[model samples]
Target: MEFGGMLSLDFYLHQNPDGGALLDWSRRLRIAAGAARGLEYLHKVASPPVIHGCVKPSNILVDVKFCARLCDYGLHFLASQERQGLAGYVDEEYWLNKSGASKECDVFGLGVVLLELLSGRRSDYYQENVINIVQWALPLIKGLKFSELFDTRLAIPFNIEPLVRLARVALACVGNSRPNRPCIAQVATILTNLEMDLY
Candidate 1:
């Protein structure tokens, strides 16, 4: 598989080459759905079940067609040792349990990525404040302030049902406790349906 002109999802999270948002609502949904499917495959279809260790924007590469490809999967052992950039991506249970990375951790990371995809804000900081994406988005998502959660770069779509559903999925992945978090398979299913609805 060659990502000749592929760019990391992080590239789209910020300003595009044209100084405008490259990811509109539809493209964002497609990327999210594709990324979910990739992770679901790794966790369920892959023999022995692989843990992504770190699931962040930079690890998800988007091709010219906006196809998401999950990279650096099953690197928990090395990533857990470094623990440098894994700050906001990994779940709290990972540090508390000391059992190493798990599927739940990956879900939490994807939730963060989804939040970043929704809002143009980075995981490291929101606006000028040093708040994690989950911390910043949870309240807005809970309050049903869907408008505020959308990235300002993209005009809010008239039919917001899909975006709302995606937000709920992100909330489930990050806001819920590890035991309560939906597995990647379930997330992929929801996102797949949402993507299909876009047509």
Candidate 2:
């Protein structure tokens, strides 16, 4: 049950003792792939097919070897009641009581996580005019301005092909309506392929 490290994915993505990210591009890619597979297992392989209501980075724990382990699965009802943690991670439909915390909503959260990994920003991040991570990154990705979409803390990899593909996946997961969002299985396949290409 216990995977290892106490640090959450958010720690490496946003908070670190050194005031900088601990994960580089390759490590982030590994974490993304692992997290995707974890969600995929929950959605497709689990006996009851659990929906991880809370799919943000804090719920994603990172192991010693940088593998991602999803925690706090199927706890969205509690989070939804409290409305404490769910922010930009959840889709617009999640707020409408009738269409709350479905598999598609989980995919939306995973999409936000992917954006966080790529931009090293929080899902709920805000500034003077900018609203959230999805709002900020989607435009850059739509415009094919990938150079501006990456986390400045880490150097952009020479082979940006993988990141571009990842961005497109994120776009599909978040940009589309709930009925149109790609399933977690599809997202996992794309990320797994990207991870394999790295090796």
Candidate 3:
């Protein structure tokens, strides 16, 4: 259960020399897919759904094999109540409500994290842009211009099929309306399919 060192998403992204290689892309997909599955289990498989109020890169841990394990469940709250913690990661719709965190909020945060992984940039870096990564990336994705949206450091092929799929998932996760967001299980399924295609 213990990784030798504390490996946050930032650490993994920066420390790895081959950040843009295909192998690295596969690794990222695995990590992200694992995180999606973890969230899926929490929402659908658990007896009582647990809403991970905070879903950021710092909270996602990487193991020796580069597998992802979500941590810091201490901030998890019941889906039925209003959220009371972490402003930046929380969905705007649920920000002021004290009713407690919900699955949709977590999904929004997950979308932000996924954008960071793909962009090799921090979420805060794009704060001045008014819209978050999802908003920034959607237009490019819809226009089939991934080269304009993808991480410049990464040499993802021009094929763009996988990148499109990933972008779609991210868009779904960060939908402005909670109901428009895909459930964790659906996100997991999409990511799992993308991971298999990577192999």
lDDT of each: 0.87, 0.86, 0.74
Give lDDT: candidate 2, residue 171: 97
Q: Ten-residue segment with the worst summed lDDT in candidate 3?
A: 78-87
- Determine the backbone clash count of candidate 3: 6
> Which candidate, 2 or 3, would have the higher TM-score against the true structure?
2
Q: What's the distance in Å from true for residue 56, model 1?
A: 0.4
- Per-residue CA lDDT of candidate 2, range 90-165, in tens? 8888877664799999899999999988888777643456579998899999999998989888788889999999
Which residue runs does candidate 3 get wrong by more than 4 Å?
A: 14-23, 74-85, 125-131
> Over the stretch 130-152, how does candidate 1's per-residue lDDT look in tens digits?
77789989999999998899988
Model 2 lDDT at residue 91: 86
Query: Model 2 off-target regions past 4 Å?
Result: 17-21, 125-129
Report the lDDT of model 1 for residue 73. Answer: 89
**Tell me, what's the RMSD of every candidate?**
1.9, 1.7, 3.6
Q: Tell me each candidate's TM-score.
A: 0.94, 0.93, 0.83
